[model samples]
Target: MFVIITYDVGEKRVNKVCKKLREYLTWTQNSVFEGEITKSLLMKCLNEIDQIIDEDEDSIYIYEVANPKNIKKQVFGQEKNFDELFL
Candidate 1:
């Protein structure tokens, strides 16, 4: 599955959440992450995030597509490509 995850987390937990997500997805932009992940991996990722976030103060949104080919994105401004690697 292809997942796009966006989150609004309290300041204190931001780094923890971001770091966890980076392990399973690409950081598409600030507080935004997207990538193809297995169901088990996604579950594990969310479980880790759940442990890091305060349920009362944080929120995470996930959008999923069964097929990656169906994703059609349009960016009006500068686009971020987090998939690039730097050595």
Candidate 2:
């Protein structure tokens, strides 16, 4: 599946979190990172990431692009361009 993981991380932790994800993600674009990974592995990565993030200032949005029909599965701001597909 195609996974698009976006993060709002503290400036201090952004580099660290990006470093971790770099090991798995590819085809990076701006602050948006994309990769192909399974559900279980993605969850594992997210769990590990949660440990490293500062809850007070950092947040994450992990999108699992599996079922194209499920609009709620989309990450924030993504639906605007995809309204025709899911609306």
Candidate 3:
């Protein structure tokens, strides 16, 4: 599955959260990450994030491609320097 993750974390935890996400996704912008990930890997990523964040103070948003055939994903604005594929 493909996912776009955006996060808002406390100042102290921001670096920790960003580091965790880099293991699973591409850092697209400040506070933003997107890439393809397996369900198990996604869960692992979230679980790691869950440990680092204070639930009441931090927020994580996940946008997924529910139906690949019907939905098309597009990126507008400054183009990414890397190719779309990860490997």
lDDT of 2: 0.70
Candidate 3 residue spans exceeding 4 A from truth: 68-77, 80-87
TM-score of 3: 0.81
Q: What is the lDDT of residue 22 in candidate 3?
A: 84
| TM-score pick, better of 1 and 3 | 1
Question: Best candidate, TM-score-wise?
Answer: 1
Name the top lDDT candidate: 1
- The lDDT values for all models are 0.92, 0.70, 0.86
Q: How much RMSD separates candidate 1 from the native structure? A: 1.5
User: Residue by residue across 1-87, what tens digits does model 3's lDDT show?
Assistant: 988899999999999998899889888778988888999999999999999999999999998876556666577987562325344
On TM-score, who's better, 2 or 3?
A: 3
Comparing 2 with 3 on lDDT, the higher-scoring candidate is: 3
> For residues 6-50, could you state the per-residue lDDT of candidate 2 as single tens digits?
888888888788767766675254456676887787878888898
Q: Whose lDDT is higher: candidate 1's or candidate 2's?
A: 1
- Candidate 1 yields a Cα-based lDDT of 0.92
Off by over 4 Å in 2: 67-87
- Candidate 2 versus truth, CA RMSD in Å, comes to 8.1
